[model samples]
Target: MSSEIEELRKEIENIDKQLIELLSKRLKIAAKIGEIKSKVGRDITDEKREQKVREYWYTYARNTGIPDSLVDNILPILFSYSKMVQINPGKKKNITIIGYGGMARSLASLFSLVGHNVVITGRNKEKAERLASEFRFVYMDLDSALNWGEYIILALSPSSMDYIIKISPKFSNKVVMDIFSSKNEVFSQLEKLSEIYSFNYISTHPLFGPLLYPVGERIVLIPSKSTKNLEEIITFWRECGLNTTVSSVEEHEKAMAIVQVLAHFYILGLDRSVEILKKEFKIENLSDFFTTNFREINKIIEKVNNILPVILEIQKSNPYAYKVREIGVNELQKIRKELGE
Candidate 1:
């Protein structure tokens, strides 16, 4: 309507076009760097380099009067895309994922994106087929997939031990890995089965949630008694753009007890408390008064609720769960006394 407004809009459009062109040029250079790294056998993610780049972005943002919030939000996404372009997998292997759940889809997406041959299989053939078709992968029967795959990922939950037990005999000589959250009891069970049936069992825990193309995510790898070719397995995950950390069963369980069990326990309590307070105070439209920190906490609450079963399972299975929760409650009581509440 106004000439000044129209002129400003045109200028913004031109700037947008220039930004897109600059991004394309940057990605092209990143691809060339990826080529060099691959030739030299270097990992895709260079953490020190990433930190320097992040500092540079922040310094530039400060000099340009850009908000720290903008830098915080945009840098991770830019870094993720940069890593996605730099992924150059080596000697693709046949990966069979044995579930049609969120974690299954996430791994399938990452493996397929990195040029691996993937097959989806489970008892529910229809769900398996649908997930496979999403990534142009084939869906095979349980026995057929187990026979065909060189690496089998048991993406099912820890409660699915019966199903895992039934199929334990077929895993002979195959490199089998289970992505269970808590490994206290499950690890021992699987390790014993691996020894009995003569399979290489490697326990794994993905540190991130079910997200497609989860570049730069971290995965914890715990080796069982029968684990072999450990270096090769590490390389496989590295090539798929995941940061891998090796830990023992005890260390892994302790870490999860603090990280997952304690955190979820507090969040679940907060969620229930929030609901009780809301109903007691006759508070409606409480979101309108939410602060930025509360908004973030609410997001975590929503995510925890979405996967309540998994969260509860971790709480139940983690050996340190009782200790962690007791400490958490004691800390809250101390805070309450300090506040004179």
Candidate 2:
């Protein structure tokens, strides 16, 4: 090893240690601020303060000739952690998640981070255990989970929801919620089952991807007739650092038809168009020519491709899907006509 290289490595290690110490100091101060906010009955997240800090970071980067990307990438995560430390859900509850998929992990991360006792359970005990291990939570069988949990989250696919009916009195009188993307028929079915089984049923759609600890994300809540404590549920989520929007079943479904059905349908069409064009042009290395817009679009296409089954399911089940697709086709035809094609 060269002496110069070893000296540079030692310098890097010292810088890394300093960085860690600085971050720790910052978080400790943030935690103290959180304590003050709690005493005054203030919300954990102050958007104005975050924006002011972000603006200062950008100015500092500009003056110091540092790249904007460095600050942009790190600041959001830093802010999320700061807010996570600030959140103190005074009354924590037992949350049972009924799947081991991405959404299950996302919710479990948030709930467990805020001191909620979380139990991961599903038909596949191994998968449940694996997810539970990631969050330092325990895995239990469905019967035990239902009995142990105060708030039960149905995090499985819509197709797998029938499994809920298999368990009887276990879910009785519990606060049960389903986290389905589209709630056309499944929500109603779950509501009926809740009635039959005597459970409090609420339908919810998390308006974000499967990112862990989805802090500052929005969740749509559609409380059914059995969900008498809607405000309490909303308060619980707000306390956990999530913004909640309450809506009727019909309103929620209508918004999703446009948000999910129309958006995914167009993105699917765009994906196919890109693939066919790529082959026709014999462009084997598409990334070599990717512009900023193309890169962003490709990212969305990749996400859609990974979740094609869920996308297709939403397309099929959403009642306004056909109408949205028809409008999309008509718009495309108008564009082609404009180009004299």
Candidate 3:
């Protein structure tokens, strides 16, 4: 039995080796295709092609009796890495990030991964140096980083507007962007600052949370009064493997009202209600009875709990917040009435 187990392990090791070789060959082909795309001025990502590939994987998985769950889990990682290999940032820019927080680290990781020069700078030199070392990026003082960077990203929160105001003059002639989730107030403030500082302000909101190596995520770009070189900015984000959407400030606020405000509000209520009911009903060992759907929801609840402050800020800042919340409450009431609760 032990001898048979050893043989099986050896066979698995051999398969792993073949898998590595095939992945390497696939990436090499992707790199060559990237070169062709660069020469022809085509974008790196082809959504249609990706969809076809996903269908092929699903069909093959079904044929081989492989679980759909496995394909679902693995395909995104494969797609991300494939796009990573195909990224050809033709003229890498020096990007300076103005905060050393999670979002800053995420952007630094992506810029460094795609061969762009990134500098981490903030008031806290120690934190900046630590984050820079994680990606082998440069750690510079705020002023030096601003001067050195061709593009500047303000990764700080809306509450830090005073700090932003103080440094506004240093942004003269620079292309500056922000990654604020709620843009109603922040966008207007930044737009006004751009006019006074003589800088090009392009508002941006990264759709994904602050996860390292957030390849293939979507980022919304809103061109402000001083925005120039819009096309160049789009290409820069695409080269970093992010899908870009250009939106107006009003449109962005409305969308976030539904996407972030309403959804997070519902989840926050659900999280609190679940705990109250769990205790009220004296339920215990709930994990043992968790269905797949409940488990998925629990994960979302966990994520929301982790970022409560950001969630609350979005809830407060969206222009349509009050109306959206009223609608949400009414819907909940309707559901309760239907259930005779």
Candidate 4:
């Protein structure tokens, strides 16, 4: 039995070494992929290819008895190193972030972590002065010190994006981009300045809550028009450890309506439903019949506890959110009348 155990251990060690060697070889291929994409200036992430990879993983998981969820989360991190192997081998670029708030600070740290300079800007003299005390070369405004940038990141609110793009006066030679999650309004506004610089803009929506994520998060980039240059920039973000998908403006906005809008409405409805449930006779007077009942209630309460702030966001940004709420109210009113409300 001892000799058998020793043989099994030796086999496991050899398999582990082989796995590492294969991963390293795959990354070498990934670096080559990066070079080709970078040279042609094509976006690194192909959603179709990603979908195929995901399908393969699930199929393999079923065969190997591994849970899909566990593999899903680690999928990005494992594949992301290939992206780093690709982009990190080249010259690091300076990325300018125009805002001093949460998004700006987050991007600054992210870019800095990857050995890129993060220059920040805001027109507010007081805020800029405070920001300048830091290391990312804070400027009072764009006009004062605008040029000498490679990739300019617009990290302001959605509404503020249009105002900055049209009036900024200095984006003529830069690869200007924004990270707004919804793109209908912003993309349409960019068309007004289409002649300012042909295809010099792209809008992106990071499919993540700002503070809750790191790199390898799904980032949907809505290119103004898919061009060679825009593709290279996509590669750049992917190399920075983000999974990116390019979309038409309509596709992005419609998707957000479903993703953010529907989700927000669902949570809001759930909270309202739970509140009504709490007023029920059982909740007001718990008994032996409520063993698991209290536990379920507590779980829902926890969900709503974190949902209030998200409700605020949905009410403000998602256009489809209010409509859905209106639908729900209308249906409830119909039910009430049927029951003689």
Candidate 2: deviation at residue 18, Å? 7.0
RMSD of 3: 2.0
Would you list the C-alpha lDDT of every candidate in the order shown? 0.92, 0.86, 0.90, 0.66
TM-score of each: 0.93, 0.86, 0.93, 0.61
Give me the runs in candidate 4 sitting further than 4 Å from their true place.
1-89, 125-140, 197-199, 225-228, 275-341
Better of 3 and 4 by TM-score: 3
| Backbone clashes in model 3, listed as residue pairs | none
Tens digits of per-residue lDDT, candidate 4, 1-341, equal 99999999999999999999999898899879877876665555566777798899899998999998788786887776765666542468867677776556656655654667556676566665555456545454666445756777788776586568665557666777777766656666664454455537777776654432245466777766423487577767766656678788777766677666665666566667766877874485433445565667656456545645644654666656567567757887899999998
Candidate 2, residues 100-154: lDDT per residue as tens digits? 9888989988987788899999889899999999989999988889899999998
Model 1 lDDT per residue over 42-121, tens place: 67778999999989998999999999899999888888888888887889899999999999999999998899999999
Candidate 2 C-alpha error for residue 304, in Å: 1.5
Candidate 3 has its poorest 10 consecutive residues by lDDT at: 36-45
- Kindly report which residue stretches of model 1 are placed more than 4 angstroms away from their true locations once superposed: 1-14, 32-51
Specify the poorest-scoring 10-residue window by lDDT in model 2: 37-46
- Give the residue spans of candidate 3 off by over 4 A: 1-13, 36-49
Q: What lDDT tens digits, residue by residue, belong to model 3 across residues 1-341?
A: 99999999999999999999999999899888877876665666688999999899999999999998999999888878887887787788999999988889888888987899889999999999999899999899998999999999999999999999999999999999999998888888889999998999999999988888887688999999999899999888887878789999999999999999999999999999999988998999778889999999999999899988889988888899999999999998999999999
